[model samples]
Target: MKNTTISDLKIIQIDKIKEERGTLSVIEKDVVPFQLKRVYYLYDVPSDAYRGGHAHKELYQFLIPVSGSFDVILNDGYNTKTITLNKPDKGLLIVPGIWRELENFSSGSVCLVLASEVYDEDDYIRDFELFKTLKTT
Candidate 1:
């Protein structure tokens, strides 16, 4: 397999609509490169707590911090990059075959994730070494 880098990642701007009721941010299905299969959010994360210590083999995920802020550390078994997500209308697209970890979550941070696939244990590469191997070939 060819190596992937941070350059392959994308920052997607979610459309925000302001109304008398409240601000609305949306993740439209056709707006993204991939179709949405699963949607999950992380909330009530403590300052020291961390999430996402694995990489997906065939799944893609777009992460957005709907509230507060956090850093998404991405590694492709070669180079590493960190992208911060603090806005509800901004998303970080994490491609497959890239090792990712979410850290430095601020108080009351809510991270919303849009996935390309549903829950499948076999699609995940949880070990760093295995991810590295898979990233190379």
Candidate 2:
């Protein structure tokens, strides 16, 4: 985790196929760096609400805005970055050991999360202070 920085965060462009009917986007195993183990989404969130105020120990997540848009605030315990997800054909790849906060959600926005691991409470570092302390050591 010492070498992991904000630069490790990547904006992955999903493959989009356009035809006469409509556009289709595909996300297969080759597109993502890790093998997907779980999938979920967030919807009907209030505009002022915030989510994901924690950092994962081993889980890697790929976040996609399936509908509408939202902002993802990422902190690597040293630097911070705020990225907006507005397109369905692009996704943000969040590596492990990075604190993430989801906010500024537009109306009717849907945030799709693809996880590399299953739900594990022990893998989460929920306190910012603790995360910072751990990153320094």
Candidate 3:
């Protein structure tokens, strides 16, 4: 297998249009670095909350704030970084083996996540200490 670094996480912005009626945004799979296999969105949630406490073994994901603003905290076991998703045109791409936590969601926030693979429990590393060890070794 190849080594995955923390710097691999990419931030990309989509194209959006605003009109009198409403706003429209488009997220293309080809434009992103990873090929998307699944897509999901989180809505009707509270603020200052936490989500996604696990790390994937072979799944890559891109997260975007479609409606409001939020912060995504990413931990590559050895290092950590916080990325703010406030624009519908912008997204953060997360590579595999990185633990991510979503928090500080603004009102009416909609978080859309595009994944490279389907759901698999074995792909997740929930323990932080074990995640660190895996990254080092």
Candidate 4:
């Protein structure tokens, strides 16, 4: 597996239009800076939750806050970074081999994830220590 670094993570904001009645958000394919193949939304979750404690080997994902706010903790073996996603038009792009944990979900928070590939268990590196060794050596 190729080594992944923290620089691979990218934060991007989508286009949002606000009106008197409501708002509209748009996320286009090529405009997102990455090719989107799969789309999923996370909702109906509890507060101060812990989710996504694994790392992918080949799948690249972009997390966006659609409704409310949330915090995404990313660990790339040596360093850990915390990103807050509160805007409906903003997103964080996470590459493979980086472990991610999502927490501190606000009320009625909807997180949308756009993946580069389909689900594959073989692509995951669940152990943090092993991931560190693999990245360093």
Candidate 5:
């Protein structure tokens, strides 16, 4: 596997059009680095709770806080970094093999996720220790 670090994480700025009544955000397939094949989101999370404590072996994801804010903790099997997502126009790109955890969610925070592949249980690495070993292999 190529070296993937927190620095490799991309913050994508999707185009947003604001009008008098409401706002619209656009995500074009070609504009992003990957060809999106799936989409999901998380909302109504308790303020004190955390989410995403795993890594993927072959999937890529882009996350955005559509409503409030939350912190994304990224670990590349060695180093770790935390990034806060608050803007609807900004999306965080999570590459494969990086352990990720979402924490410090504000009340009513909505995390919208766009994925590069469909849901596959075999693609997920839910254990951090196992993920660390996979990175070195």
Candidate 6:
């Protein structure tokens, strides 16, 4: 796997079209660094609940808060950072080989995810210790 750190994370501003009624954001292939392969979302999560406690080996993910807000805690084996996503027109880009944990979800919050790969259990490093060890190699 390639070496990745917290520095690789990026906040992407989506292109929006404003109108008299509402605004529309567009996320085409140009907006993302990788080819879009899968899409998913999290909703109706309890305020005290936590999600995404694992890291991916080769998958890249873009997280967008389509409604309400939430906090994403990211780790790169040596450093940690927290980012709050509260807007529909902004997204957090997560590169491969980084640990992520989602928490502090407000009521009725929805997190939309765009992924670079399909679901593969083999690509996941669910154990933090194993992730750290793999990072050194």
1-137 in candidate 4: lDDT tens per residue? 55887888998877888999898988875756657778999997789677899888788898989889989999888889999999887889888889899999999999999888777789888887887888788
lDDT (10s digit) by residue, model 6, range 4-45:
999999999999999999999999867989999999999999
- Residue 70's lDDT within candidate 2 is 98
Q: Which has the greatest lDDT?
A: 6
TM-score rank, highest first? 6, 2, 5, 1, 4, 3
Q: In angstroms, how far off is 59's CA in candidate 5?
A: 0.4
Give lDDT tens digits, candidate 5, residues 91-132: 999988889999888988999998999999988889888888
- Once fitted onto the true fold, the runs of candidate 4 whose alpha carbons sit more than 4 angstroms away are none
lDDT of model 6, residue 121:
98
Cα error, candidate 3, residue 108 (Å)? 1.2
Question: What digit string (tens of lDDT, one per residue) describes model 3 on residues 16-92?
Answer: 78899988877664767777789999987789677888888899898888889988888776678898899888889
TM-score of each predicted structure versus truth: 0.92, 0.97, 0.88, 0.91, 0.93, 0.97
Query: For candidate 4, what is the lDDT?
Result: 0.86
TM-score of model 5 (CA atoms): 0.93
The candidates, ranked best first by lDDT, are 6, 2, 5, 1, 4, 3
Which of 2 and 4 is the better model by TM-score?
2
TM-score: the better of candidates 1 and 2:
2
lDDT of 2: 0.95
TM-score of 6: 0.97
Model 5: weakest 10-residue lDDT segment is 1-10
User: Native-vs-model 3 lDDT?
Assistant: 0.83
When 4 and 5 are scored with TM-score, the better candidate is 5
